[model samples]
Target: MIELLTPNEMQLADRLTIDSGIDGYALMQRAGEAVSQTIVAQWPDTKIVAVLCGTGSNGGDGYITARLLKVAGYQVTCFTAGRSAPQSYSERAQRDYVADEGVIMPLETFKADEFQLIIDALLGTGLTRNVEGKIAACIDEVNSCNKPVCAIDLPSGVSGKSGQPMGIAVKADLTVTFFRKKPGHVLQPGRALCGVIRLCDIGIEAEVLEQIKPILFESWPNLWGALLPDHNPDSNKFRRGHVAVFCGNVWSTGAARLSATGAARSGAGLVTVVAPENALTVLASHLTSIMIEPLGNDTEKLDTDVLSFFKRRKVKAAVLGPGFGDQERAKRLVYTVLQSKTEDSDLKTLVLDADAITAFKDHPLVLFAAIEKSGLQLVITPHEGEFQRLFGNFVKGKDKVEQAREAARLSHSIVIYKGADTVIAAPDGRAVINGNGNVLLATAGSGDVLTGIIASFCAQGMPVFAAACAAVWMHAETAECFEELSPAGMMAEDISQMLLKVWARLREMATPSPSPST
Candidate 1:
């Protein structure tokens, strides 16, 4: 689980490292040397290189890079942006480059056609305002060249804190970042703009992270693998945990079945699909290992039957939404489930997704109030559209991570904001950005499959936030495996079946190794 730092955190890390012992300029030299080495390795045949330097430390690194490239016999042209004189480390880097006989060109004289490789050091992670005037023009020219570009820290004009582009940004073929990666490196628009990211160690020791103590991490097995339920020899079916999935109407029963299968395959001991009487036949025919229970079409009976099953089976978790229609009845079912309880135990977990999330769009506070009363560990899975509907005016312009964190805080539930870059935020403020998953997961019924996976983990005694992180990573791993067979043709059911393989690998990883012979 690699730590993801924000721009402010990264600045503090650098300051702390310099204060500890290492010279700031020495770190800049190392960064320049690393970038120079990478360029030579990636493009051995390159002759001319254009280095676009800003007026700050990012430009300092570019200056040193230009000097190193010149020493290696490459025709290097250094272009400096802005009218201010280089200060601090950048001043030293410029003086050294000039001593080495490297010519620093003005932005107006720099030509994109003259170079084979373009190094975008125009702006670094500290940039907050939109790119405008000369800097923006320089970025525009570099992008228009269509030549391969290598960014120094991050692509010029990309927000290091948020992954958003500031008006316009340079789309680099490769990005070289020093020390640890920033949130922008893994987040959406910035991740896309940064083609291939290469992390270079520039003399910052690992211990610096101890003082910074970044809360966000890249989603991986090491982050939440230890939290998975153990299947001991003495474990029984009931001990493993039971999951109940609320089915949609007769015409839309497949979604519920998908959720049930996902729950069963994800290590839930028993999975039952609580369906309306009209949908029982379809669900029973589609499911074999999973059980099906019928609740009459009457809303009053449906509420009573669901509560009765929760008490009778000691159900650990429940999944709602999916193909369930978005109507008053669906909203009523959510309310009933939240309000229902067992005599001796509270409803441990619940997953609300798709139509279930949209059902409370107009009055989300009512749902929040019920969750507060029920004391249920809740997980809400919402894609972009659903998130917009549920969160409404609160998350209009916030970034994905911020949006999820705020939503989690407001509802006091784990919020899984789904996308290419899925972010799982807990109410206490810990968040993880999923690094796994592929484009193949964009297929239909994928969210339904995710709903089951998360609920199953929660039912198996994993904490709500950890369960969500594990489910997201496993879902991505399943998609990665499915990609090997058929990238485009694989369906949601394929992912459910592939969970067995993913779980096998996870179990193998968790097993203790044999001790060495004495």
Candidate 2:
């Protein structure tokens, strides 16, 4: 369930299932049955339903669902814009169940406003081109209806590989997908549109995954929960690991402080905000558990302070580029930190975000070289704008996951491409797409908080890739819990204070519930 398959992979999975002797028609029948069951369960009172069926296998699913619903005594109207007969088992399904006259109507004859529910079976995961023509009009009308929608597999007109709407796509209230999820179910826009997804086991066996190595994964607690920092009962601050978040000047110190607080809240043994001499006051005023270190913006001072920290203290990870302004100084400091390291210590990690990423736009290769030679694990958090500023269409036509992966390969670092659909991609072609984040996380400084959590996890000894996934999942989890509780509105600073809530929940989930006394 964690592994996200591309459209091609999904097809292969289906073919594998079929080859394993499961009837292809049986698979469609199962899909249709699941869709009908989910729809009935979700909207028990709704009697009038519109089912849009295309000419492909997807249309077959709809035709079967329509017939099943009709038998179930629900008023189901089947409409088709199908140019040709249904494909494969769908043709059989239509011939067997949809023989009643006036049961399946032309697509043009259907009216969206009259339906209490809608099922989008017009398209499946195979779409690569943009949606146009009659189907586009149908999607637009369905979106406007505001009725509950249940989409088969994924919403029609969405690419299972990329999650981009094929021009226009169905906005489903409920998406009933079979077996494993596709990328479209997790990647954004499509993710948002696929509301309340319910994955059903439609006879696709799990053993087929042995031959198929899925590249994309869904980021959630299950992936990194065990990797959560193990703090011994007698462990002190030093045992947890120390993290330093480098700050900009006084006016922009808030971002750095937010990151530092995030680190401290996320169980870092010690957290420090490395600020310039002038920014110390601002940082000191806001931070208590997190310490503040003063360093000059000059490269020499940065090198000395960072190298000294690595030598004297156990500085596990250092963060740069939350709000660090001057590009020249950010560049100089990044290079300085990249070059400072200790072989025996946990000083093999550096995290760059915001200004740190943009600082390397002019000569990204230089930064990449520094990362490659430093022998330090590098993690960069950049939103689309920051990413574009640095890579400049390096992955112009690629999807978010691909874009992040390519950037990571080129930069020789872990890339957290931030957005509603956050993609954490490593240079080794491994990636996890975060699906829980909502618009509430778009507030200012939210990413800074995420950066802090990432640095904190790295300091606490998690592998960089797992740490990134853990941090992203925790950030989204916090937002989700917040929405459930207070939800008045959340800010970056508020996230740090709320970490304890999810942290406790994380520990609870990891701990097994006691077996009931028999």
Candidate 3:
């Protein structure tokens, strides 16, 4: 797992190294030199360089970089926030560099139009408060200047803990961050503010992460590879996996069939839709390959006997709550499916969506215990409104990553926080910022398609944690593939059809055999 550290945690990590015999000043020297070299390499044609420095270590880094740039024959002027020098070794290095020949002018003295490149070293990761006074004014100047700006470490005024901007932040043309990328670097507004981020190794040994034990990890294929299901040539329908999607009453039954179709396409050899008796006839008229099972007459309680019929046929996964109405019986069925907790139980993976999520919104704690008792990995797909309804405002945070992480922790299940920038967070502190999806996915019922995609992967025995990641990645990639298609007109069924193409692409990309002998 690649660890992502908060600004405070990063400071503690640096402190830990200092106490372990490495001098802090040595790290600062290496950091400054690294930035200086990176600037020369990335933008050698710089005529005038304006370096902005604050009172902290970030300012120190800028001072050193400016001094190095000056020595390299580029005209450099240093602008300070008109604050005293920092006492730390990191701050001292920057302060000493500016003591000789570097102009110590206020932000007003520099005109944005005058410089070709502006290096922002103001207010690094440690800032926790909102930008104020001259700092805020300088940020406005940088934004208004429209000149190409390169930020050191992270863009100023963006919180490292969450991706939220502290009142205002510097929008950089490029951000050169050291070591690991922070949560801000990948999450929302921070990701946008940090333009074209380049991660440089500033000699912070990877081993130091072991002591800090960062709980957050960037999601990627490396983490989910083992969870990908392996299929044999001799695999039979039951041998692979069987999934049952529960449909709601007539008006709501389509979502369940969509899930069934998605599951069937996603490698589940046998996919069934359990529709309410009234809707069974209507469902049968549309669904061909998917078989429909009618619910028992005992409407108040889900018929365990009827469910056992599928169990006897060796159903391995179940998707509930998609189109199911938020009725008393729907709630009962959710509890019934989760009651089978034994290792040999037919249901090993459960996907809760739409109405199922609505049922638990009033009391999420009820589902958490049921999930633990069921001993099955659980996945919950909720849009922002549904998410807030289920988990309350506690899940709301400054960054989508933070909110999703909080939701995963509270629910004890994988939380697929659906949006144009969908984020999937697992309880184990792993998340993926889906980059492949396009605006075309913003249409209605798209989330239903996403829920089905994840359910299909879960049925194939992908751990709920990894299945969510794979589903999100594939879902987004599929949307990007069909960019020309009208997003406004796209429906859930369209995604069901596209799943196969996305999986084939993923398979081809993952396989590393010698190219065909041409």
Winner by TM-score between candidate 3 and candidate 1: 1
Ranking by TM-score: 1, 2, 3
How would you encode candidate 1's per-residue C-alpha lDDT over 184-217 as one tens digit per residue? 9989989989989999998898888888888787
The order by descending lDDT is 1, 2, 3
Q: How many clashes show up per model?
A: 0, 1, 0
Q: Tell me the tens digit of each residue's lDDT in model 2 across 134-237.
A: 88999999988878889998899888888889899999989999889999998888888898999999999888887777777887676777777887899998
lDDT by residue for model 3 over 139-197, one digit each (tens)? 89999987889999889999886777999999998998888878777666787898888
Find the candidate with the highest lDDT and give its number: 1
lDDT of each: 0.86, 0.84, 0.76
Q: How does candidate 2 fare on TM-score?
A: 0.94
For model 1, what is the error of residue 62's alpha carbon versus the real structure, in angstroms, after optimal superposition? Answer: 1.0
Better of 2 and 3 by TM-score: 2
